[model samples]
Target chain A: MTRWGMVIDLGRCIGCQACTVACKVENQSPVDAWYAPVVEYEVGRYPDAQMAYLPMLCNHCTDAPCIKACPSGALHRRDDGIVIADEEICIGARACMTACPYGALHLHEGRSGELLGDGTRNTPSILERYAHERHIEGTVSKCTYCAHRIDFGTEHGLTPGIDPEATPACVVTCPTECRVFGDLDDPDSPVSRYVVEHGPTGVLRPDARTGATTAYVGLP
Target chain B: MSAPVSALPQNVFMDRWALEPKTQRVWGVNHAGWFTLMGIGGGVFLLGRIFDITLEAGRVLGLPIVDVVSFVTIAIGGLILIADLGRPLQAWRAFRNVRVSIISWGAWADLVFLTFGGLLMLPDLTFGDSTPFSGLGWDSHATSGIGRVMLVLASIAAVVVMVYAGAVLARPRSIPYWHSVAIPIQFLASSLAMAMATLMLIVVLDGGDVTRSELLATAGLTAVLLVTIVVHLSTRTTAPGKKESIERLTRGSLRGTFLYAAVGAGTVLPIVLGLLALGFDGGAREVLAVLTLPLLVVGGFLLRLDTLRAGIYPPVVSLLEAAQR
Candidate 1:
């Protein structure tokens, strides 16, 4: 009966992209596909211009449009409220890609095996990377709320939001402590408490009726 | 709407605040080809069956030419669909979840149409129900009951194949321009028109007679397609990317493809030519039919192509507007 979610405090976000790098390092997503990139935009005219950052990731809605759009039943939700795309069943129709209001899902086309541009040799070769459930070719992927870590943590008697070993890499790596992660169903959880404290926390594409788990404070 | 600072390919994420629409890169020429072929195949099958069911005038002694065309196009379209997939080998997995997924519905529809459609054509063929049957069984090929039922099943599947191609696109709310009930109906109209035109050409080439109702069906479907185009053009909804979609089709980058090719040449020209051909008979009428049918058929393909290319996703910023709402 758990619903994992996150609440982002935009007021506290410094736009340093620490969480972005953390997500990339942890997830090792395909090339040009950032699972948790903080997209920055400028506000106001030149005289009062300032950068505003929006950290983008899968909202993991209760009524996920991607899951509904998928013809192959590749995308599914776990009992603990995590959305996952199973590589074995995925036919790569890309319908979920179009159905998603927020461009959270990414198509992995075996870019992990290829060498990076400019001969940087930054990332490890595909063979050297973690083989199990890492990157699957010709399948859609998105943020899984680090369910692997959560399951591991739960088995070992650790709290998700409080324990760095259990939480998502992005939440753990944020220097400003802008990202809060916990079970949304539990009122005592950090995420629920944060949302309760900050009344009217905003969600992206509320009109989509996605019942978005990710909420934001100081949206402007 | 805030103005963009850089002129990127619209789809690329940039430092823009405004909710500009970006063209979807998911479906391309391959998908367009798939949609076009499926529509044509389904249309031809449905039109031919209408004659069989309603007027009881469908060919029984020989393989119905229209059904063959339908089978071929659907086969080709199915291949194209597989080719268009990221994982082509696993394309069979797409047939699951027909209840919830429109794509699955389409896959099942195509499969059913192919299976039952091919089977239904067998008993009607001169050699189909004989040699192999006589050798295997005592040549009593009188399975009295299922002809009409099979025909109805195949016909329904054919209709789904034609309509679901549009429903697949229409089901996506990410693009407001395509998220309309009008799209499937328009596709249905366009598919039948294209099929009718193709049938007309076949009749002309084979020296078979052209029926008046066929021409009337063609004209009626074409008229419906024309009205749908007008509806598409006049859709100035405030649904994020709708304005940009309209602009793209009307006066923007996609204008040449949408306006000139899909509309002017494919749609309007055929109507004008068909109207003029009504004034003639004999060889003149035949020549006019030949010219007009090709346009209608080609127009059908272009309509699918241009529409697929015109699918613009409201820029990433559009989410903020929805968030605000």
Candidate 2:
């Protein structure tokens, strides 16, 4: 009964984009397909203006619209409440893209955008950096909550949020540790504790009622 | 909160952020193209059942002329859908989630419409008047009981194809403008009007007699379509006020396309022309049908394209809302 969830303390995020770099390195997403990126906006105007960073990713909702809107049955939520796409059979109709209120879904462009003819060169070039990406081309991609690390850690008797090995690449790489990932079902989990202490709201577009598992501690 | 006309609306704090509304790039002109083709094809096919206009028309390559047009148009639309897909080879997998997904439902409907509709026309192409059905005292394949059953099935499928295009857009709750029940009704009205107008033009150009009944139906449908568009545009302005989808369509960059082409040329122009034609008889009506019909078809396409292009995902952060906060 593990409902995996995340809580982001918006105040703690410094807009450094370490999570973006870590996600790219870990997931090897194509140039256009940013799995996790910090979106910043202005709070005030002119003389009183201030930049506000909001780390955005897949909320991994309880009643996920992307899963329901997927015409190819490519998107599915696991028993643990982690919504992952089966890229093997994705037809890439992009119905899920329109359905997601948060704009979480992204199409994985096949090309890695390396320098042309870099693959033919012998020296350490951009080709070496993107030669072995595991992502399937022309499939819809999103933040998977680092299911790979979580699965391995759980099997090895390690707690996800507490252990760096089990944690998501973005969560672990975060300099301020603003993002917290844990099982929502566990009453003693960090996410649940944060929910109790700060009462992080479910999602930005609450009217849609996606039942988003991810919550924000201080939504601007 | 007025709609920001420019792509970038002076977000000084962050260079790249969702400050103003953003148009959804996923389903744009490509989707509009496919939907328009399929919807018109289905609408024309369905309209033939209501009136004997298509049945009275001569055959092309041993198949009813309407059937040939419907089949080819739908097939071309199918090609467009495949072309839009990222993985075109695996397009068959689109039917894997028909239960929950409206897009899947549309795909299934398209299949049924093609299969049953194609089968209904097969005998005419194969054996003509002296086929197996002719031996059973039926002059044509369309005169048989099974043929009538197939027609019923195909018509149902065609109706679904016409409606499901709008339903697919409306299913995405993310886009506030599209998230409405009126969209499907408006689409049905618009498609039917365009379909009827196209049929009349074809009949007129081919030196066939123009009927008043056909003209009236087209006019009625066009009027309904106009009402739906007006009502839909005004009512859908509730989400986040100025930077909403409706605002983008009505007052933003898409204003010319929506107000002029879709509303003026597509709906109002046709209705006015239809009235002028209906007032007179003989050659004048035929000429008006010729003039108005093309406008309806092109306007229909523009209407769909503008509406689709106007789908603005509500601004992530509004300066006005932030100021109020």
Q: Pick the candidate with the highest lDDT.
A: 2
Find the candidate with the highest DockQ and give its number.
2
Off by over 4 Å in 2: A45-48, A114-133, A200-202, B1-15, B126-141, B205-207, B236-238, B241-243, B317-319
lDDT, candidates in the order shown: 0.76, 0.78
Tell how far residue A70 is off in model 1, in angstroms. Answer: 1.0
Every candidate's DockQ is: 0.39, 0.41
TM-score for every candidate vs. truth? 0.89, 0.91
lDDT of 2: 0.78
DockQ, model 2, C-alpha based: 0.41
Real contacts retained, model 1? 0.36
Query: Candidate 1 at B96: error in angstroms?
Result: 1.8
What's the DockQ of model 1? 0.39
RMSD of each: 4.7, 4.7
Would you give the TM-score of chain B in model 1? 0.85
lDDT of 2 at A220: 57
For residues A1-220, what per-residue lDDT tens digits would candidate 1 score against the true structure?
A: 7889999998788899999888877877666466788877666656666677788788888888888889899988898888998878898888988787777788765544333333333464553355323767677777888888899899899999889899999999999898999998899998888888875688776656787788888775
TM-score of chain A of each: 0.89, 0.89
